[model samples]
Target chain A: MIQLLANPQRFMDFSKWAAPIFGILAVALLGTGFTLAFAVPEGVEGSGGSGDAIRFLFFHPQLATMSMAIYAAMAASAFFGFVFRHLLADAGARAAAPLGAGFTFLALATGSLWGVKTWGTWWIWDAKLTAELVLFLLYLGYMALLAAIDDETKATRAANILAMVGVINLPIIYFSVYWWNSIHQGSSMGGNHLGPDYVAPFILNMLGFAALFCALWIVRVRAEVWRRKAGALAVQAAGKS
Target chain B: MSGLGVLFRRELALAWGRGGGPMLALPFYACVATLLPLAIGADTGPLKAIATGSSWLALALTSLLSLERLFERDFEDGALDLLALGDEPLEAVCFIKCLVQWLATGAPLALAAPIAAMALGASPGLTPLIIATALLGGLGFSFTGGIGAALSIGSRRGGVLIAVIVLPLFAPPVIFGAGAISQAAAGLDWRAGFALLGGYSLFFTALGPFFMAAACRNALS
Candidate 1:
């Protein structure tokens, strides 16, 4: 797969077919995931279980999980780009950043909304929230750096370094919940069974979200490649004159 | 000792002797520190609580604002390419340049912070801690800023570009440094925070030179 996509022409060829497939998958999975997220029953324990259990899906665990998963995908693409020097991998990294940023915004916004509902506040200086805010800033920093540099190669290198550095903050962000007396709940995905009722939708949503992320990533990568090609052609035409 | 030490001293002297560089940073820092209280209001209680952090943040921003010119002048004059290809290791040279930069920017800012702290209603006992934290934290900023400056050479709006690249990396240091000072100002045990700041300074001190040199090489190439 690496060898096949190493060539730009071959990657372009592959993307021609892959883009529509990803687009369809993304739209389908996202539609399904949101439906399940909103439409599914609140489980048997519902209003009777620990308030923690009742409020779990409102913000903390699900959105946090999605945020981390999106970053993981970006990091994975970045690793591929760095290790193999794959153009497609670079495109993948570039594409995933804005989408992952959108997820981060969702996580923060929803988390804040949940906080307001539960804690009677819109925001707090809790470690986890602060770290997520920092992650959002990192994403903005990456986008700004990419846009600032006129040279694509330089932009890529600068963005690549920023991504690598920003990824270091993720572990700190996750552990902030554990390390401090944060209002954000501990991970629900860890430890023992999630029980079939909750587990099924959780797993399905995660899978669907992951697929949706992949599809969005592929679409964005194709657009980025085409933009660069167009930019190159414009430069060439200017030189001809 | 001879080559890098000589280079180091020269860089330090050059950065210091240039009246505008170090002097310019001082007023910028002072103005920024003074403005925060006005913006946030003169409530002494909150000002006292945030004095240390506000001062450190002001210094960080001032240092960052000045960092762009750290290598830009040398690079433009073709001195950086020569230094890159010269007998002295670029990493060692970069390390020395950053040391000089910190001495010029961080050291002076540290010296000046007490005035800002006093204006912000900081207690007398907490003043030294603010200075110490600024010095240590400034070292880390200069080192990291060197890497950013090197990486951003020849880029548009290089100063802002370098800050965007460097500021996030500087977050841990800022947090620890400001926390230490804030704790001290609040009459709390700040040792742990100070220790963390020291650890970060040490870590970045060793790591930054390598990245800065690599970036300088890339820029030169």
Candidate 2:
């Protein structure tokens, strides 16, 4: 399977059909999932659940998990890109970042909105929230490194190293925040579970979002490959002229 | 090893004389410490409360000021290529550069941290702990910050790129270092934070140069 996707042209060909299929599937699944989430009751008013905004659950967990899932995927591809030095792996890793950033931004924003409703404050430096913030910064750093470098191969190489370093650093960041919270007065904002009514939609939405990420990632990777190919072709045509 | 010593001494002298003078980061650190009071008004109590944290933060920010120049001039002027092609391994080159950086910027900042803290209204008793934490925390920063500097060695957007690269890596040391002082202030087991701070420095020491060398090689290639 890895060998198969190692070829950029083959990967592009496969992604052509796969991207739209996942995109349509994601749309249908998420559309139904949001409708189901709204139908869930606020669950006995004054309870710690985020009240009517409890519906935000469907978006938040999936976004949070998907953002992480995408980082993990990006890091894995980065590992491959660096170790194997394959263009497809580099393209996939590069393409996953902006989509992952979008997911992470939404996760942080939605989670904060949920926090506002439940915690009675706009923000608290909870460990989980702080960890997410760090993750978001990590993503931003990767994108910035990618954008700043003039050479395509060097940019990918440097960004891959950063990604690898980040993947290692994530656990340390999380653990340090966790320990720091424990030492400080760790706020117990505990009512953020998918309720019985919300469970089905939450699961469905998570799957949908995962599909959406996959579709976008494939599309972006294809675009990168085409961009590189066009650049090579332009050089070759210039040489002939 | 002697090669490392020579490199370290040379970098230290060069960095010292490069801009305004030796220990340029100190005034930046002090100036930052000074500004916090102005920005927040003459509120010593609140400033005192955050003295340890703010000083460490100032140290981190000030460290960034000098770091983009750590490798940029060397890479641009081709000094880095000669160093890479020299007798010492690139890893050792990385290690020595980070050491010089830590000594030139981080160590002095560590020694000056207590003064900065005092200037920001911290009591005299917290001075020793604050200095210790800053020294170790600053050490960690230099090592990891070297990776950032090396990675963005010749980029046009060097400073901002270096910050973005190093900021996330800076979190653990800041947390551990500040936690130590705060724990000491609270009359708790501050040694645990101290141990973690030491561990954080050692963690970067072991791995930081490896990454730096890789980044330098990438640029060199």
TM-score of chain B of each: 0.94, 0.95
Q: Relative to the unseen true structure, what is the C-alpha lDDT of residue B179 in candidate 2, on a scale of 0 to 100?
A: 92
User: All candidates' TM-scores?
Assistant: 0.85, 0.96
Give the DockQ (2 decimals) of all models: 0.37, 0.78
Per-residue lDDT of model 2, residues A14-57, tens digit only: 88999999999999999999899888887554444545877777
Candidate 2 lDDT, tens digit per residue, B1-221? 58878888888788788562235776777789888998888877888888888888898898888788888888889989999999999999888888888878888788888888888777779888888888888889989898888888667798989999899989998899999988888889899889998998988888989988988888878
Off by over 4 Å in 2: A45-50, A191-195, B18-22
Clash pairs, candidate 1, are none
| CAPRI category for model 2 | medium
lDDT of 1 by residue, B1-221 (tens): 68887788778778878575568888898789878988999889888777777887887798897688888888899989888888989888888988888888888888888889888888777777888888898888888788778777767778888887777777777777777776666567888778877877876789878767766665665
Worst 10 residues of 2 chain A by lDDT: A42-51
Fnat measured on candidate 2: 0.70
